[model samples]
Target: MATVNPPRGMRDFLPAEKARRERVLAVIRARYRAHGFDEIETPVMEEYSRLHAGIGGDNEKLAFNVLARGLDADAIRAAADDPAALTDLGLRYDLTVPLARFYASHRGELPGVFRAIQIAPVWRAERPQKGRYRQFVQCDIDIIGDATARAESELIAATLDTLDALGLEGGVVRVNDRRVLDWMLSSFGFAEDERPRVLITIDKLDKIGADGVVRELADRGAATEAVEAFGAFLRRPSSADVPFGEQQIRGALPDGVPDEIVAHLTGIGDAVAAARPGESGIPVVFDPFLVRGMGYYTGTIFELAHPSVGYSLGGGGRYDGMIGRFLGQDVPAVGFSIGFERIVDLLEGEADAVDRAIVLVHDRDVTVAELVAVKADLVAGGARVRLEQRPKNLKPLLERAVADGYTGFAFVAAGSAPADIEVKPLA
Candidate 1:
């Protein structure tokens, strides 16, 4: 017998769950649209070559590759030594890579600078757990072809606005720059070739602590001086206290951290502050050690963190080199993604003004025509109407109506007119 459930790491949303998800997505879509981002979509799968093109970082390994069709057993056996030979396509693990491909394909049709909104499902081969899903939606807003800090600033502003619109106030954004990390590494005596591997270890600072990072780097046969220097820096007094400010950004890093990187981080804060103003409650933190796992991040990187969650709500960074891989020329790009599944779980169910919903509970004796007729009248009056057959037990049906976000329910008879039905508050 087939298992009566969705695949692991996937879900089946009931009517109420689907509605709640859609309601939350509506808020996100509208907010992104208001900020001048035009929604776009690409195919869910891309060529396996593109998906594994070294740009997707660790996610490429997690890609669900599709095997080439019509392969004979001989051919399959031939390719068994190299699994990639049997595959031609793979599901995207994130939106940025697809967006890069899309921009390259349609560069001529797009504006000089493109603001895009992509709210779509992405797949990864992850072990499912609470707040993590292999098949989950990602809500992304990106700006491509703009080299200045303006792109990052606009993205941050829009993100904060969308969070506020979703009633998720007090969300914090931790900011960093890839360039700062590179500079800091050089200052600490790490050689050019080893910086990538060194950064990988540095990213573990949170989980392993300073001593663990130093020990791991030393064991990995990293430069003795570089490890000791960085270890000293990490263990030094903690200067990056929050309430993100220009001074705090400076204090977080070593003395030689470049001025341009500092200015870029501060500029984003100033821009967001101007657009959102004093009333906005989100704090932007500057973390020198924020090494986002994505290797393609070129300049700035930021992650959205909330006090209530142990993990990041969402994050992204500048990957200026990404579009160039597809288009054969560099194009500045920055994006911020909202972890849709995580945010949806955190949102408290509330009434959406867009839906003034009601239910028409009709008996078996009532004609479909009559039921629909009453529903039509209510719908025309700007109410979202649903017609349900009245069960012998009315209490359960009425309770479900409330749970499904119907504000009121009315009893309808065989030929009851809209005016004749008395609507009672389901709440």
Candidate 2:
């Protein structure tokens, strides 16, 4: 038999880790529920084109292609000869594509503006490291068909509260409008075709400092003056007293784009502040430098990050036109995705610190009704119950359960009701 271990970059979460994740997920789910969002599930696999079409930049590169499955050993061996014929399906790149498909198919049944919360695993075939993983879970909440800024603002506020609830402290939710990035780039003298490549380079500013970015522009063949100007442009603090004097930003706006694009951004800034005043619980800022790598985002783009982690816990933005690619009708939308795996990594200590636990009874010939009753009673009394597998010995079971993270135990004899259980507190 082959060695039994999860594939590289994936994980086999032990019981303790699973419980901790569940607790974090519960807190997030509670906030989503409070905000009146419904829950929807999307498949783990989707066709390659549908999943990757609107997914821009590095994400498309990282998608894990699941070309064949259950294809017996013979077929698998044949795939080694011809790989191109293998990319029929892929692990979903992200939740947004699946959500877009779902919305397109069920728009009629859903309310005019649909709000949903989705929690699922997403796969990426990246080189795995301490914080970067090939497989991870995304907890996303998105609202579609409604073009209201208030909805977006509230979602940001709710996301902050949810993060706080989960105990991943000190994260800053950086906000910027893609439209604003468009404005800024045009201000810096970039044409429409150059925008994607330029923004891709600019997105690296945080990882690679200003000098590095300037060097990248030079390498890309941007003129020295243009590169220097672009650097100077990105570095200009939003607080700088330089008024919106020149047509730099304004000229970038497409012909007939109302002045309201700039105005709407200003309004969004105010709404963000008003939604959560003071204390910097999760500070939101207008970063001219926040050019998210994805090409699909058409409006506001945001990311949440911690000072130490240096990568996003998760980030998302308004991809107002994504649904139109499939449905053929534009349905404006905004969303945010929480990186559950990153959150778990950043919060591994929290789970270690938690002391609560439960253990199950071990016995053969126990009546199903008795076992069920016992489980129900403990649950009703606010205790978690973990039923022991059959044919397991008490000593090894107790040791395993404790090592696996259980702080309490209850033993019920075979054919007995839960009322007859001898609840023992395990140390």
Candidate 3:
């Protein structure tokens, strides 16, 4: 027989692990509902064209494409040179793209400002590491048709509240506006066309230090003076000194940029403070260099990072133009997606024990009807019941039950009535 194993980057969540994950997901779902966000689910796979529609940034390249099936050998040979033509569908890399497609198709049925909650698995063909996987769930909440800054504020507050409910507290939210980057680039004398490439390079500032960004930009043929000035500007102490930093940036920019951009950024800060006001409140920092790599984020962009985790717990921003690609009209939207897998990994040590009962039939002569009755009684009494045929040696079975985290056990003998089932605590 050939050896059988799961694919390299995927995992098999056994019963206990799956239960724990479902419990976490339950808490998140309830919290999202409380915030007036209705649940929505899209297909795991989307058309290749929609998946690669330029909204996903570099993540689009990681989509797992599905090749056309039932084609003859001659037909396959004719299209062998063009792989894009052969692949008609692909697994969704993220929720936002599919949501955009969903809203476009069902706009009439949805409210003008739809607040949607999507908790589903997304696939990406990236190299897996410690908390990263090929398939993982993303808990996302998005508000569409609301152009006001309140949408961003509500999404941030709701997300933080959900995190707190999950027992994961003290996360820091780093806020930045994409327009701020555009203004900065303009201030540095970078042309509109050059801003995208420069933003992509600047997005790597976290991975590659200040000097590395300058070197990369210089290598990419950016103006020497602009590169040096931008590098110096990025190194400034802005996050710690928002007011002074804002004044300096405003001074550097030409007259074209509006003051409303700064106001919007400040509003998000104030709203975040208002939403989480207290000594134990999560901190919201205004970071100038916090450019989310996604090209779809038009205005406010924020990322939630926990001190315990090396990566972001979740992040989202306003993507007003995404739906426009399909609808042919702009719909203002803002979203935040909690990194479900990372949150689960962080909470693994503190996961609550699954409360369940196992019924072991010690007597082999126990009738199937008797066992079913016992199981039904246990279940009706609000117990998670598992039925197992007991072996000659009860010690091994008891030991296995204890290791499986069963809270209690019921031993059913041959011809025992449902009322005769003896239940005992495992402890």
Candidate 4:
């Protein structure tokens, strides 16, 4: 006999849990749509070559490739140990890549500056951890064909609003730009080719600390002058005490950050703050070393953070060059993604309704037509109705109903009329 369970790193949600997840998703979908994003879906799998394309950064390594159909032992043996040689398609590791392909496939039908909402699951082949899963949902809202900070600002604003709708407070968007990072590295004498690997190392700064970043870079044979300069910048004295405004943004990085880069960042912050004046202050902060892992991020990058969490709630960035791989020409694009699994864990479960969800506990002898008639009447008149035969022990049955979000119950007999039913609060 073998123990049975869901696949490793995946989960099976009970009815109540499924309802709760759908509730959270509903709020997210509604909020994104309210901000003018139209929903679109893409296939879960894409061509292996497209998934293997360089744009996915390190995640391409984790893709779950499908074996080519009609393969036999002979075909498998003939391929030796190469997996890519056997696969024609792969499950998407993230929504952005498929979205790039989707836009390229349907460009003529879409608006010049299209706003899209994509909420779906993406797969990766990684060891499961407490919060990390092999399959997880990513709720993303993207704007294509917009090159300006306006795209970034809208994303930031909508993300904040969605966070509020989810009852997660103290949400902030940490902002940076790939271009600024490139310029900063160049100013420190780091060669252009060294920057990508260096940026990957720098992304670990939050976990490894300044000293660790320096030591690792030194060990990697990075240019001594560049490593030393970057290390100094990381250890620079506190602008921490200062408010996060243009002044703090200037102080955080070395002097002579190109004015246009500064202005673009400033504009995004200003627009988001203006839209959310009721907050303590601006909800966006500038982080000079905020290197999002996706290599496709061509310009501004950002991560969502809440004061209560040690990790990002979600993140995305401008990937202007991604669509070019399929479309033949580049299209300006930027997106924001919500870490659906992480955010769902952060909040408490909520019932879709309380007293409005009614359970009809009835005698088993009652005719099916009569029972369904009353149930349908209640449903039509604005209530969630469920039919349950009266069990010998009522406690367990009612308890299960309560857990399923029913807050009230009514007793029904063979002749009980819809008008005769008296609903009583279970709580």
Candidate 5:
């Protein structure tokens, strides 16, 4: 027999993994609903064009294209040399793309300000390493046609609250409107066409450090002065520093700046301050350095990451014109996605109520009644139940149960002879 295994960067989500994931998703869904957001689902697979068009820089590199299935040997042989000619569909890269299409197609049916939560699997082809997978889930919330700074502020608050609810600690909601980043880059002499590249490099700031970012900018043909100024902006303290007792660096804005971007930044900062009250430990401050790389973000952009994970958990921003690409009319929108795998990693220790195995001993046909009774009881007591075949020693059975994620093992044996039940704690 040929050995079977999951594809690279994906895993067989055993009972335990499935249970823990579901538990977390349930909480997220409930929280979204509490805030009056309706649940929405998009297809797992989408057309290649729809998935990649203007998603962002570098996102195209991660898309996994799908070829035709159930083809005969001749068809496979004919197309073996060139696969691109084989198919046009691909697994969805993320939920946001389908969402934009959805908004475009169904704007008339949806509410004035459509609020929705999408929890589903997304595929990427990046190198799978620790805590990074090619196939994973993204939990997203999108509100279209609402441009208030409070809407963005509420997203930050919701992100914080969701992480808190999941029992995760030391997470930060780093926020910076794209306009602010654009202004900073423009100040550094980067033109409008080059801003996306600049933003992409800056997005890696947390991982690459200031020196690395300077090198990246230099490699992109940016002037040495531009690199230094950009690094300074990243290192510069926010205007909020004055009221919060942090050192103020370059609090004074330089002359020759666009007033629109400045006003937007100040307004967003005020909203963040209001959302995060005094000394709340999770302070949302203006970091002109905080640049979300996605090209689609038109206004305020934000990211949430675990301090321990050392990578972004998820992010989103206002894309007031994305829907217009498909509908030919602007539909103002802002939204964010939560990387489900990243979140699972952060909360793995605290997510304990997962799959529990119930060992069912089949002594004979009649013994199934006791087994059923025990299974029922266990299920009623908030546990998952399963049947096990009987053979005396019970040692291998216990071992198999443990391997199958039976946190609380229950051995159902033939009874009514004594009605004496023994619950043994497996150590």
Candidate 6:
């Protein structure tokens, strides 16, 4: 027999593990609902054109494309030279793309300001590591048709509240505006077309230190003077020294850069502070160098980080022009996505106690009807019950049950009565 295994970067969640994950998801779902966001689900697969439409940034290169099925040899041969010609669709790399398609298709049916909650798996053909999977769940909340800074503030408040509810309080939300980044790049003499390329390099600042970023930029043809100037601004020794305040940022940028953009960043910081008051420890601060990797973000962008995790827990931002690509008219939007897998990994040690009961039949003659009745009774009393034939040694069976997360057990024999089944606590 051939050995069977799950594909690379995938996992099999046994019952106990699945239950734990579902419990965490429940907390997230309830928190989203409490904040008046309505749930929406999009297809796991989407048209290849939509996935490759330039909105996904670097993630587009990692999409898992699906070739058309039932093509004969000649049909396949015809398109062998161009793989994209044979591919009709691809698994969605993230929820934002599908959400944009969904909103554009259903805008008439949705409210003027649509707040959506989506908890679903997204696929990526990238190398997986601890807490990073090729397939993972993203808990996203998006507000469409809202152009004001209030949309960004509400997303920040709701996302932080959700984290706090999951016992992930005190995390920092590092925020930046795309416009400010654009202005900064322009000030360093980068052209409008060169800004995206420079921003992409800058986005890796957290992963690659200042030296690496400067080297990569120079190798990529960024001017020496421009790279040095940008690096100098980004290499400030402390957050206090970084120009984040309205006055400070205005002084750093060119004269014509909008002052309102500075005010917007300041307002978002105040809103976050007001939403999460003293001792909450959830600091929301402006970082001029915080360039989210996604190219679609139009205005305020933010990322969530925690001391417990080595990477960002989740992040999102305003994409005021994305929906227009599909609908032919612009729709202002802002969103935040929680890294569901990373959050679960962080909370794995604090798993909720399992309340399951396993029934072991000591005698072979325990009838099917009797076993069903006992199981039904336990289940009716809100217990997760499992039935098994008693093994030669009760100790080993009980040990296995305990290890498998069964909290209680019941022993049954040939003449056992359903009413008499007494579940004993394991610990």
Estimate every model's Cα lDDT from 0 to 1.
Answer: 0.88, 0.75, 0.83, 0.90, 0.71, 0.84
Candidate 6 error regions (>4 Å): 235-257, 278-282, 356-362, 367-370, 413-419
**How many pairs collide in each candidate, listed in order?**
0, 0, 0, 0, 2, 0
lDDT of 5: 0.71
Top TM-score prediction, candidate number: 4
Best by lDDT: 4
- The runs of at least 3 residues in candidate 5 whose Cα sits more than 4 Å from the true structure, single-residue gaps closed, are 1-3, 68-86, 204-216, 223-282, 354-362, 377-383, 402-427
**Which tens-of-lDDT digit does each residue in 240-274 have in candidate 5?**
44531122212544455466555654555566566
lDDT of 2 by residue, 156-215 (tens): 777877887777656677767787777766766677777777777887887898888988
Task: Tell me the TM-score of model 4.
Answer: 0.97
Tell me how far the alpha carbon of residue 314 in candidate 3 is from the true structure, in angstroms, after superposition.
0.9
- State the lDDT at 10 in candidate 2: 87
Comparing 2 and 3 by lDDT, which wins? 3
Q: Assess every candidate by TM-score.
A: 0.95, 0.81, 0.90, 0.97, 0.82, 0.90
| lDDT, residue 74, candidate 4 | 96
C-alpha lDDT of candidate 2 relative to the true structure: 0.75
Candidate 2: segments with Cα more than 4 A from true spot: 54-56, 66-86, 234-259, 277-282, 351-380, 386-399, 410-424
- Candidate 1 lDDT over 1-427, as tens digits, reads 9999998999998887888889899999999999999999899999999999999999998899999999999999999977589999999999999999999999999999999999999999998998778999999999998888899988888888898898887888889999999999999999999999999998888899999999999998899998999998888887534566678877887787778778888888877778866754436778888999998999999999888777888999999999999878899999999999888888755424336788888889998888878888998899988888888898998888777778888889997987897878776
lDDT of 2 at 83: 49
Comparing 2 and 3 on TM-score, the stronger one: 3
lDDT by residue for model 3 (1-427), tens:
7647677678888766887899899999999899899999899999998988888999998899999888788888899997678889999999999999999999999998999999999899989887778888889999999998889888988888888899987877887889888887888877788788888888888899898999999999888888878887766664334332345345444445578997776677667778776744336766667888898999999999888867788899999999999999999999999989888888985776666666454567788898888888888887877777777777787777666667778778877777887788876
Sorting all predicted structures by lDDT, with the top scorer first, yields: 4, 1, 6, 3, 2, 5
Count of clashes in candidate 3 = 0
